[model samples]
Target: MDRYIPPVGRWKLARRTQQMTHSALRELLKVAERPDMISFAGGLPSPDALPLARVAEVTQRILHAEAIGALQYGPSEGYMPLREAIAERFTRNGSPVRASQVLITTGSQQALDLVARVLIDQGSRVLVETPTYLGAVQAFSQYEPSFEQLASDADGLIPELLSPAQLHDVRLLYTQPNFQNPTGRRLPLDRRRQLAQLALETGLLVLEDDPYGDLVYEGGPLPPIHSMAPDAVVYLGSFSKILAPGLRVGYLVAPEALMIKLVQAKQASDLHTAGLTQRIAHQLFTEGFLEPHLHALRARYREQCKVMLTSLGLHMPLGVTWTRPEGGMFLWVTLPPQLNALDLFDAAMQAGVAFVPGAAFYAVEPRHNTLRLSFTTSTPEQIRRGIETLGRLVTARLSGLS
Candidate 1:
């Protein structure tokens, strides 16, 4: 008898399912997971930074003391205590974030998805940065909104080019102002103000996705654009970086009017974020597990960043420029125009190193010579070795060695 393998591709599938493509970063991540590979690829917080003992302690406390509340189904808007905790933290900037405005989600990624579902219609205009976070692009693309990238530089997004004509029919403007993914560019104080003003003048809804705002190394925190233009912006915050990503705790603050629609969307999506994690996260937040933990994370990531920077300086060929971020896990690299980072990917793996090509982050035209390196996971020694391997590969490519 013939084997019973079915023709899976012949089955009818939804247009949306057919349209969806796999994430290149995820594909690369599989390769990076090998024991032999030293990956400067994933935007993973260091294991050393994760407060495992404290997390276990919190989990024990929640399970023992508030077992019913922790395990039960939660409101679609989120756990009230966690929401309150998030709202209080928002006041750190003195912008007066209220608990009423906060809505907890599974993750900030879900917040993006909910906002896109609520606000975007097919072909709606959505403004984004030139090299935005791939996750955002992936999340928003499902809603079929048209994307327009605003002009940007080392100082971050420039909304100066946001003319009145372009603002017509624009639904949302997405940005990662502090230590952006792939690029790691922090928007200056002036540009943040400019974006807020632009939103006020044109009524462009700003999605200020901030997962790394508190990880600043050199300077004090800049107020989020949502604070500057509360009515005009939707603020996203995540505990993924500061706390364990496994907790998947994230929240958003939007206008109450908009929050109603978002809550409806959240209800249809997954009912709500998990109750137990929210309770544990809230306990951690209120009991002061964050401050000392955050300090340790900053110290560890700072050292790793320093190692990568030094390695790049010593080994990379001249004209291969990279961003020097003040904080965060990632740094962007722009190779000389002649060398395409995509072409170098396989070679990098063969040489026992991995990186994310920059083109994957773009919503429109992509620069072929750019790539992103994540420094937080790898140790100083591994970073040195990985950079040396990558440098040699790049050099060989430059010299016409296949």
Candidate 2:
């Protein structure tokens, strides 16, 4: 008989791409389940904002009436009614997208992965903001692309930092233009136009991920970059933030040429987003239920944001800087250069609070001094208590070290 030996460890048998691993955010999800933990680690939408009762009602209606359509295999592009709804939204917002240009994805996360599959190849040069959405970075990493970090400020990406030579080889530029994750920085309208112009002039593709656009707490709305350079940008939007994450409905608006490729990639990935979910999303929209719901959500989130900002102002240690976003789930915090966020994470946890270290958001070597705090999931009281605890921990750490 052959020696009793396993063929190989799954990790060893896995493709080199598997070595990349999932995001730190996913890892934090495990910690978030601890009832004792006050987590600012995940970009979770508030449970109060989710239209749970509305979803249950619509879901029952769909099963009772259109069960066949809801359960049967659907088109890979998306459910037709859902696509039309998404297109109408874009048009109403002034982007004027066609339903044919939309491809429904399992989630905006899936949209990111599909774009990576279709556009990124080995050694493809991709440009990203220094501190960007970690999920996008992880999704694009599997393609083995070479990432170049773009410098950014509170106003968003620095267009001047983009060089002509860099543009020549860049396969894509990825940005979270509206209330960017981690940073909570919105790109100014002028910078958005400049980014569009650069992409158009250089023939570079832009992946504009705007999941947080609709969650604005207190700012004037700005047009999407795709609206300015429709031909050159691939825009990703999601119902996860405004509607509900459980539906997992998101969409990509791409040029017709690119849309075809993405649809094929999406088919290979998961066929299409669930028809039942799409139908439910359509029902919610068609019945005119989301507008007032969104208004309520904005009000609640704005209150939470204010709580966190006020707490930070009162408790944050000296030599720290943070962004005050007009609308969005998160705020980026930069600690003294001598401090490492990763090392401080445990201390914060011990103090009954948790947040994501900002280093994981970078594709290159990370900044050890930065961290991200989200205000959406926690209660206003929790935000205040958590920040106070975090401040105490920081003060203790600095005092002990000094």
**TM per candidate:** 0.96, 0.96
Off by over 4 Å in 1: 1-11
Candidate 1 lDDT: 0.88
lDDT by residue (tens digit), candidate 1, 238-294:
989989799998999999999999999999999999999998788888897788888
Where is the poorest 10-residue window by lDDT in model 2?
10-19
* Residue 316 CA displacement from its true place in model 1, Å: 0.8
Q: What's the distance in Å from true for residue 8, model 2?
A: 3.5
- State candidate 1's TM-score: 0.96
Candidate 2: regions farther than 4 A off: 1-7, 10-14
TM-score of 2: 0.96
How many pairs in model 2 have backbone atoms within 3 A of each other, for residues 3 or more apart or on separate chains, i.e. clashes?
0
| Lowest-sum lDDT 10-residue window in model 1 | 1-10
